[model samples]
Target: MRGKLRHGNVPLRGIAIVAILLVIAGAATASATLLFLGEQPSPPQLAAPPPIPAPGPEPDHALRDGQPGEVGLNPAPIAAAQGQLAAGTQPSPGHPHPSYAGEVSLLARDGVVVSRQATGFALRYADAQGPELPAEQQEKTQNDTIFDLASLTKLFTSIAVLQLADDGRVNLNAPVADYVPEFAASGKQKITVQELLTHTSGLQAKIELWRLPPPARLPAVLSATPQNPPGAVYRYSDLNMITLGVLVERMSGRPLDAVVHDRITAPLGMTDTGYRPPRDKLHRIAATEFETDPPRGLVRGEVQDENAWSLGGVAGHAGIFSTADDLAVLGQALLDGGTYRNQRILRPETVRAMLTNYNTAFPRNAHGLGFELDQPWYMAGLSGPHTAGHTGFTGTSLVIDPGSRSIVVLLTNAVHPSRTWGSIGPARLEIAQGMALALGPPGHDG
Candidate 1:
C-alpha cells in the first residue's frame, strides 16, 4: 500500500522516514549554527551576583571616650605601641637612659580617645652634671601636668595673626613695613607677613635675644637683617615668629598673651593652657634644664626657651605652657576647620590657608602658616600632605591628620634633666606610628 501511494520508485513509508531523518539533520545543523554563530544557545541559570555594599558616611569626628575596637581599630597593635613607648622611657642595659624623663601621650581615632598613657617623672631630674636626686624628691608625671610648649608657641602666634587677618586688620601679602614701620630697617622693608609664617623670610634662624635688654629684644627682632633675600630661602627662625608676635600686638593693640587667651584658649576652653601659668599651677609644671649662665637652676614655673624667658616669659617664639589635654583640643579645632563646640576661633578658609604649604620652592621645608607640615622624622606613619604638626623644643608634639580625623599629643619633659639628653625623635616616631596603625586605613566610616 505504501508503494502504491508513491509517485515513482520509493514507497511512501520510506519517503516519510527519509523526510524525518532530513528534518532531524537540519535541526542539528541549525542548533550548531545557533551555538557558534547565529544566536546563543540556552545556558544553565546562575544565582544572581551578590550585591555590592554601598559606602557609608564618615565616622563621627567629635571626640568621645571609646576603646580602639569601637572605632574600628585593632587593640593589639595599639597596646603593643603603648608598651614600646613605655619601654622607651626606661633606661636599658648598655643603652644610655631613656630619650625623655617622662611623657604624657594621648591618641585619638576618628575623634575617639583610644589611648592615654602617662609614664616617668616630670621632676625626676636636676642639672645635666648634677647628682641624681632622691626618688622622694621627684614628682611623678600626671596627665594634667603642664609643660612649657616651647616653640609650639609659634602656632598660637600664627593663629593670632590669622585671626587678625580674618578680622581684616592684617594683610598677608602686604609688606611688614606696612604694619610695622620699624621693620623697614635692615633692608627688610619688602618682606611680607606670609614670608615670615613660611619661614622663608630670610631672617636669621636665631639671635641671643636674651643678650639684649628686654626693651631692646623687640627692636632687635624688628631691625633684623635678612641673611638671604626675602623668600629666597627656607630658614626656621624664631625671629620670624618673634616679629609676628610684635605684628600681632601692633595690629591688635593688645599683648600677645592677652590676645591668645581672649581669642584662642578661652574660646576653646583650654583652661590649663596659656603663657605664664598661675603660681598655684607651678607645682604641676615640669622642670626644665639648669641654666648656669642665667643661674636658673632646675628651672621650674618659668618659660624654658631662653630667649622667651629673657623676654619675661611671654614672647612669640616660646613661653606657652599647656597640657596634653588642652593641646588636643587645639589640634581637634584645626581638624574641625578652626571651630570647636560652636566656638569658631578661625574661619575654615583661614585654617586651610594656614595649613597649606607655601614653601613649595623648598620641598624639604614643608611649612604651613605656623604649623610644620609633613615632617617624617617625627610624624612617622602620620606623615602625609594633609598631616600638619609642630614639635616643641621642650619635647612636646602635636600631630593632626585631617584624613583620619585623628590627633596625637605627646608631651614630655625631655628637658627636665637637661636639654642635652639627646633627641626625642625615636619616641615621637614610635608613638605616632602606634596611633596611626591603630586607626588602620582612612575612610573606614563603619
Candidate 2:
C-alpha cells in the first residue's frame, strides 16, 4: 500500500514517477512552444562602438555691418589701423606725397563688416607730376569708389577657368593647346592648364602687348613662346593669364568679360564689379596713373594696367574694377567655400583646389591655382600656410585668412598721381596686423 496506494489500483510509486515525467514534458513543451513562436532567448551581444562623425561644412555667413566686438574682435587695433590708413592719405616726412592718393579699407570677421573706412581724394593730382587738383574739382574717396583690380583680375580669371573645369568642359591637367589650339605655338604644346594657373608655365613675366596694335595683341599672346621649359619654374607671367583668357573665350564661345559678369559678379551681386564699368558709373571711379608713354592722361574710369588697357580693358591679368565692399563680399564667399547668398559660383572642392598651394616646390613664392598663399610680406600677422590673397599694382589687396575667418581689403590709388609715390607695403602690413591682433591670439574666441 505504501508503493501502490491510490484508488485506481495502480502503484503509487509508478504514479509519482509518471507525474514527475509529465511535469518535465510540460516544461519542455512550453519551452519548445516559446521558441517556435519566435520568442527564443538570445545570447548576450556586446554593444557596438559609436560611429565617428564627419567634419561639418564651413559656415556660409552673409556679410552685414557690425561692431568689432560682435565677432570677438578687439576694437583698439582696428581703430589704430584706421588711423594709420587716414595718416597714409597725408604727406609724411621724407615722402612729400601721401602713401596713396585715396583709399577704401574694409575689415570683416566672420562675415561682419567690422570696419569700413574711406579717406583722401580719389582724384587728387592734376597729373602724374604731383600738382594737386583744385579742391572743389577733386573727388573725395567714397566707400563705394571703384578702383582698378589690377592682378586681382587673375583671381576672377582663375574662377572662370575653374568653373569650366567644374562643368566638365575643361581638364586642368590637359594641355593649353587643347582648348585654344593656337596656344600650341612656340613650344607651348606641352604647357598644361594647371601650370598656367599656378604661374609655373615657364612663360615670361610679360610681353609688351600694349606695343602691338589692338588687333595684334591677342594674336601675339597666342603665338608667344615660353621662357623656360613648361613647368620648369614658377614665374608670375601675364602671358599665362592672357592665354588663359583666350582659352576661356574659345571654350565657352563667349567673351571673357561676359563670362565673368554672368558667372561670378552677377551671381555674387557685385553691382560695381566688372570689366569696363558703364559710362554712367564714371563719377564713382577712382583715377589712376597719368601715362605719358601711352599718352593717356588722368586714367580715370579706365583700367590702369597698360597691357589690359591695350586689350580694351577686359584682359585676364588686370581689368576688373570693384569697390572694397564688393571685394569683401567676394572674400566672404571664398571664406564660405564659394557661395554667397545662395549663389554658388564654385563648388567647395573647387575652392579648396584653388586655395591649395600648388607651387610647394617654390618656397616664398607659394602660390595656389589663382592666389598667392602664405605671403607674409603683405599678409603680415595674418600670414599662414592657408592664408590666401593677391595684390594689385593699383594698390589693392584682398587677404583671406581661413584660420581667423577674416578678410582685410585695402584699396588705394597709390598710383593715382604717380606709381613712385611710395610702397604701400607698410599700409598692407598694418591693416592685416590690425585685423589679426583684433581677433586676439590664435584659437582665442575674442
Per TM-score, the best of the predicted structures is 2
Which residue pairs clash within candidate 1?
none
Candidate 2's clash total is: 1
Q: Write candidate 2's Cα lDDT for 1-446 as tens digits.
A: 01111113222111221210000001112322222123333321111111111126757788999999999998987898789889889988787778998899999989999999999988888877898888899999999999988999999999999888887787776788988988899898988887898888888898888888778888888898788987668889999998889888989999999999999999999999999999999999999998887889879888989999898888889999999999999999998988999999997766766666666556667776788887766776677666799999999999998777889999998897888885788888778877877776655655
Candidate 2: list runs displaced more than 4 Å.
1-55
* Per-residue error (Å), model 1, residue 178: 0.9
Instruction: Please give the lDDT score at residue 84 for candidate 2.
Output: 85
Give the C-alpha lDDT of model 2.
Answer: 0.80
**How many collisions per candidate?**
0, 1
Q: Give TM-scores for every candidate, taking all chains together and pairing residue i with residue i.
A: 0.84, 0.87
Per-residue CA lDDT of model 1 for 74-125, tens digit only, reads 7765677677667766777665766777888998866678888888888876
lDDT of 2 at 26: 10
